[model samples]
Target: MGQPPINSTGEARTIPVIEARGVDHYYEGQGGWNHALSNLNLTIPHEEFLCIVGPSGCGKSTFLKIVMGLLKPMRGQVLLEGKPIEGPGTDRGVVFQEPALFAWRTVIENVEFGLQMQKVPKAEARRRAQEVLDVVGLGHVTDLYPYQLSGGMRARVAVARAWALRSANLLLMDEPFAAIDAINRMALQDYLVDTWMKDRRTVIYITHDIDEAVYLGDRILLMRPSPGRIGRFFEVNAPRPRDRSSAEFAELKGLITEEMHRFSSENTSIQEDAA
Candidate 1:
């Protein structure tokens, strides 16, 4: 409930829960040094759902890791709640492309795994795990092993685990439902929106699907590949529980698609002119 520093002009601003400034990162590979991210910056206020979408080679995932402190930026700093993120901390929760569940652990157990490791009281952990599982619609399969569940069920369990384990200020997701089929993907998207609405944590979600971004993000930031940089950004002014089939939703999606095309065209022109 603290606030950001007041500016000279005397306007008050709510401090962003997360802020990245002048972030640049690179990697050395067989092809020589490759820049993964370059001078990227953004600020996310409390409980904002910011989805990042870009082409394959863009550093969406890289940026997510940087935010998580799973990896450090070569340059620039990421701050969480006004303090610099030095490394992975309990304030962050992450869901990856794969469920990464323990094959032997049953659904409830998998959801409770992280809490157990953190030494949470057994009864409390089980209670929270059951609550999240029920929320994610996995309560029916709570005793089933990972192998026994369908892909969608596995994805739900993974999400449930992340949500249950921490009272995280930030939730970092990297294409968590991408592996599921379309129907299942839609279901998971609804679940995510519900959970986020209730907890109101600042969430950074990385995905390649434009529809997914449009559906879930309060704003979508598109990235450019190869020395990844933030490109265009658009705010989805639609209301929550957005109607995918509605005209407003279609228009927002169209606007993003058009911007992407224009961006791609300009990039190609610049590349050709240079060549």
Candidate 2:
């Protein structure tokens, strides 16, 4: 397991590795500009696993894109290591819902693609790619093509591909497990924790599943919809390898669920009042 995080309340102050300041995003619509995020502010400390949770259309994915530098916010900035994010960089790695593996490439070759683009030597790229594939439990299938793998195996390859990008300091996952079956999803979750524990890469995970948010995040952020904004941040005080069957896990899950219900109810009422 990796070293314990430094963000606890009683610990010495830690500098945030990522900071979102007054972030706002919008899209043009016939009704005028449709706001997606509104003056959002957040700070992610080093080596933290932060889970973003919200109802549909809360802009979780959009917020993630802003951080990934794939989408620019209409107003505000996303900073990585104190520098503003201008566009995609090697510092961030993303794993999306679809595996997006290249059908023509073998598993390890697919992982090596990005490194090759940067003109790293072929032998070195192969070495690094295989190392990360092994980390994600896909090393044994390095020779197989995407079409030859199961859904879960393909997802592992996708994650391995991202992790292979040695420059990545942060891993952004946008509902990456949404397509997997229940058993595979749980196993992948554990695998992810293991990987993180081993490497301690900062992770920003977005999901609609309450249990997942609770189980995986060092802290979970609940967001409000209709122009998404931060609602609350709940710290997970439970120890590692949290017991889902235990009362503590159930209580924390119930607490977040209750607050989410309240937030959604409040948001709906405000919209109705405006209408």
Candidate 3:
């Protein structure tokens, strides 16, 4: 069994938002079969902010894709709200690295698009869109097109669009701010944290940045590669509106970072030995 999901208070949460059981995935590549995930087991509690970090090819994105129902694990099952995920559904929403906003649509319209596709009444869709926009501090620019907005602003729009889904209780974000400049990326993280604070939703955020994982995650899950699997979990005990430069924050970040480096070094050594 994987480590049970725990809250910042170190109490095990009773309600599980996501459960992965003995998951294993593979694909045929130029290098022959590649095991992307191996014997992965995890549980995410309701409304918990879980950040996944690892070196490249560590199955962070693969596990997230499984949760989003975009890919199926060959050997195990993933359950959302206690139901097996067969395919994509409204219960989940995803934001990729690119905002991928409709170039022609304004910010509010982009946010409303998904709800409208779900056949939500227009007025209600607009209401929900505007409400989440306000949460992400994007209400003022709702009428602006994607091209007209800064990268950070556009990122916020993407977040708002996913968050606007009234039925999407789980939000899977894959390095949503990875493309932004450093200063703006930090700003966007703050906006995300603020939005999450207002409306708690089960979140699985995949990022390569250790500092980012520490700043945003309630619990940081570190995965090891080769055949990607859980390495460890680090609980972020710091209070919300976390002080990034505080000693506590630094200590946690450093610990996770060090573990990741160790994984990378070990993998590199194995490859060299095989060569």
Top TM-score: which candidate number? Answer: 3
Query: What is the lDDT of every predicted structure here?
Result: 0.85, 0.87, 0.90
State the lDDT of candidate 2 residue by residue for 1-275, as single tens digits.
14535543757435567999999999787889878999999999788899999898888999999988889999989889889998987778888879988999999999998898878899999999989888888878899989999999988888887787878878999999889988899999888888888777789999999999998999999998878899899999687777888998889889989988998899889999999
**Candidate 1 weakest lDDT stretch, 10 residues:** 1-10
Q: Write the per-residue lDDT of candidate 3 for residues 1-275, one digit (tens) a residue.
A: 14665656989777688989999999787969888999999988877899999988999999988898889899999989888999987788889889999999999999998898999999999999999998898889989889999988989999999999878889999999999999999999999999888878889999999999999998899999978999999988787899998999988888988888898899999999999
TM-score per model over all chains = 0.91, 0.92, 0.93
lDDT of 1 at 67: 80
Supply candidate 1's per-residue lDDT for 19: 87
| Ranking, lDDT, top scorer first | 3, 2, 1
Q: After superposition, how far is residue 193 of candidate 3 from its true place, in Å?
A: 0.9
**Residue 259 in candidate 2, Cα distance off native in Å:** 1.1
What ranges in model 3 sit over 4 Å off? 1-15
Q: By TM-score, is 2 or 3 better?
A: 3
The per-prediction CA RMSD against the true structure, in angstroms, equals: 4.1, 3.3, 3.4
Q: What is the lDDT of residue 27 in candidate 1?
A: 84
